[model samples]
Each structure stands twice: as structure tokens, then as C-alpha cells.
Target: MVEALKIPTTLAELEALGEEVTLRIPASFEEYLEWVDKCEFTIEYFNNEIVIMGNASYYHEKLVAEIIFCLKTIFNKVTGFSVLGSNIKIHIADLISPTDFNADVSVVQGNPKFVTLPSGKKSNSKITNPVLVAEVTSKSTIAHDFGDKLLAYKKIESLQYAIFVSQYQPFVTVYERKGIHHWELRDYTRLEDSFVLMGQQLTLAEIYKDIQFEK
Candidate 1:
């Protein structure tokens, strides 16, 4: 018989397991939030499972920073827009199962809305509204970034644009909400390529500035 996996009880134990490790052991949303509060690393909750997202790679971190910088520069003088980093947790509401994600970068128009955790406490770490969310994809997280996470981001009513950037290459994919249930996809592979986000033009050159890809 297959043995059941043990759930981690301490932050040290959870961190030792490393990144992208998904624990299928049954867990409640409250239990998952408790882990989120205790653990230093980022953790995701979905379908009653807790996924431990350990430290990102060097290029992963660099790419995320670059994207954030480019976005901030674009909206620096613009009002009613706030650029957020990965530290913020985005709550994906309207789904049957509880879902939360840490995007590489998030852009919110107007005031950001905070979500109440299952503990009945308000959390600044969690936000409910983001018009644009970006994710830096690596080999370890590419599946979740493009699959489950992408689908969940669409369900977020406040989300309009979802950007995915590759750490291994100068490639970026954008999903723009075209209709209530329709989305338009655009891909950029060259440094000169640019895309319109929230009516602002962003080129790949700026997003991948100072970024080197392995050949």
C-alpha cells in the first residue's frame, strides 16, 4: 500500500522540503493561512492542497525586478495606479476552491482592495483587485504559471491583463481580456517588440533590460 505523506508542522520543516513542492495531504483554508503566516517563504493554496514555493532562482528574481521597474517607470506619473511586487498575495475569488497567488508584479488601478483571511482578520498581504498581473516563468514553475494559475487569474474580476515572461529566453506572452469570457493572446520574442498594457506601450527591451539569457 502507498504510504500517506506527512504534513509539515513547522516552518523549518516546510522550507527544508524546497520549492514547487505540492502537498496533497488534506488541509483546510485556515490551516493553510496559518502556514502562510508562519512560513517565511511563499505558499499557495488550491483544491485543499498546500504548495510550498521556495526561493526563486537568480534569473527568476532578476527578471521579476526588471518587470517591476519597467512597470513602475511606465506608471510613475500616472494617477490611480499602483505597482506592487511579489510580496503581495492576490486572492482569486469566485472559485469553488480557495485560491491565492503571488504574482511577480501586479498593477492596480484606483485604490487596492484587501481581503479578509479565514481567521476573520484583515490582511495587507492579500489583495483582491489587480488590473494587471505578471509572472516570471521558470522550468520549475512554468506548468503552474501557465496552467492552473493562469486559469485562476482569469476568474478574478479585477484582473484584465496577465503577463508571462520567460527567464531562459527573451519571450513574453500576454493575455488581455477582450470580453466577459474572451481573452486575446499576444506573444513577443524580440527585444524591439512592444505591447500595449492599460493603454501604455511597453517594449520588451525595457522589460528585459540588463537581462542576459543563457545560450
Candidate 2:
């Protein structure tokens, strides 16, 4: 028996090697482990391809950190609700899609058991469904987040609110579930405007409070 060949180290190498070797498609956990082990590119194996993700700009990190801090403070006191940032792993096995997404901020209700797997350990698995999911858009992924990804995210039965926070503009586009299979889209830019979410109203000013920018 021949020894298993080592995987290519670079994306270019992998592309070329694809023609020669028959790869053993691994499970989600195995895929994640392989991805982490092979770090030539900042990529994630979602759907089928290796999606190379761009690094976060400083401004993006600041915004995400602030938002996470605010959410954590709010949810910690609310009870039955917990807040998480991109660090969390959200697994969707319906079609073998295990996406480790950076959910600028995600809130869920219930205490989830932490489980360890080959890929990584998840402290909260209760996030099979998120009550609200927000993505702070960037220049490169604005279209994906607002367009295609928005549609894809809508397929999630537990998703009630999908909010896209614009990086170019100081605005937010909210898609809220209206009925059984319908969603109502709304845009909010005004500071004092309140957006109702799961019976809780959040004012734009409150969410963006203390937020500063270059211009």
C-alpha cells in the first residue's frame, strides 16, 4: 500500500495538484482541522470551495469589539440570552455547510453544552438558530453580505432578524420576519429611530452611541 500524499501547501499548488490526486473529502470537523492545519491562505471550506476571507481592517475590528461589548453587557443582564461574536462556530449540516462565520454580533437564548471535536470546541451549541444576526459590511464583501448571503441566511428557519450594517454609510438595513414565510425589509439611518426586535425595541442612537469615525 502507498502512503497518503501530503496536501499541497499553497492555493496555487493545491489547484495544480487537484488534477493529479484524488482527494478524500473529509467531514465538516475533518475539513475544519485540515483548514486550520494548512494556513497558507485565510480560507474556509464552506459549501464546496475554499473561500478565502479577507483580513479585517482596524476600523472593522474596533466596531466589532464595541458592538460585542455592548451586546455582552446587555444580554448578560437580560437573562436567558447570551451574546457572541465571530469567535463562535455555527454549524449547519442540512447540506454539509459548516461555516465559521464572524457574526459581528449574535444573540441566543438558552444554556448550550460545550462540545469538543476534531476541528474545535464549541462552548455554545444552542445557536442552532439565532434570534438575531448582524454583519458589519466591508467594501469587499458588502455585496455578498447584503445580497447573496442575505438570501442564503433567509433560508434559516430560526433567523428572525438579519441586519446589515454599512461600513461606507452610517446606516443599517434590517430584514425582519413578518409572517410564516415572509420578511419585511426596512432601512434605518436616523439616530433616534427605534427598531423592534423580538418584542424589544432598540434605538439607533443607543446602538451606535459613543461610536466615532474619521469622517
Candidate 1 lDDT over 1-215, as tens digits, reads 11135555566876677755655545667777766766656778777767665557678888888998899988886778999998898887654678878888999999889998766889888998999999998877888889889989998888899999998888999999999899999999999999988788999999888988733
What lDDT score goes with residue 125 in model 1?
84
- The prediction achieving the highest TM-score against the true structure is 1
CA deviation > 4 Å runs, candidate 2 = 1-32, 37-43, 96-100, 113-127
TM-score of structure candidate 2: 0.71
Structure candidate 1, residue pairs in collision: none
After TM-score superposition, the amount by which residue 21's alpha carbon in candidate 1 deviates from its true location, in angstroms, is 4.8
Candidate 1 TM-score, true structure as reference: 0.90
- Please give the lDDT score at residue 149 for candidate 1: 91
Question: lDDT values of the candidates?
Answer: 0.82, 0.62
- lDDT for model 1 comes to 0.82
Ten residues in sequence with the least summed lDDT for candidate 1: 1-10
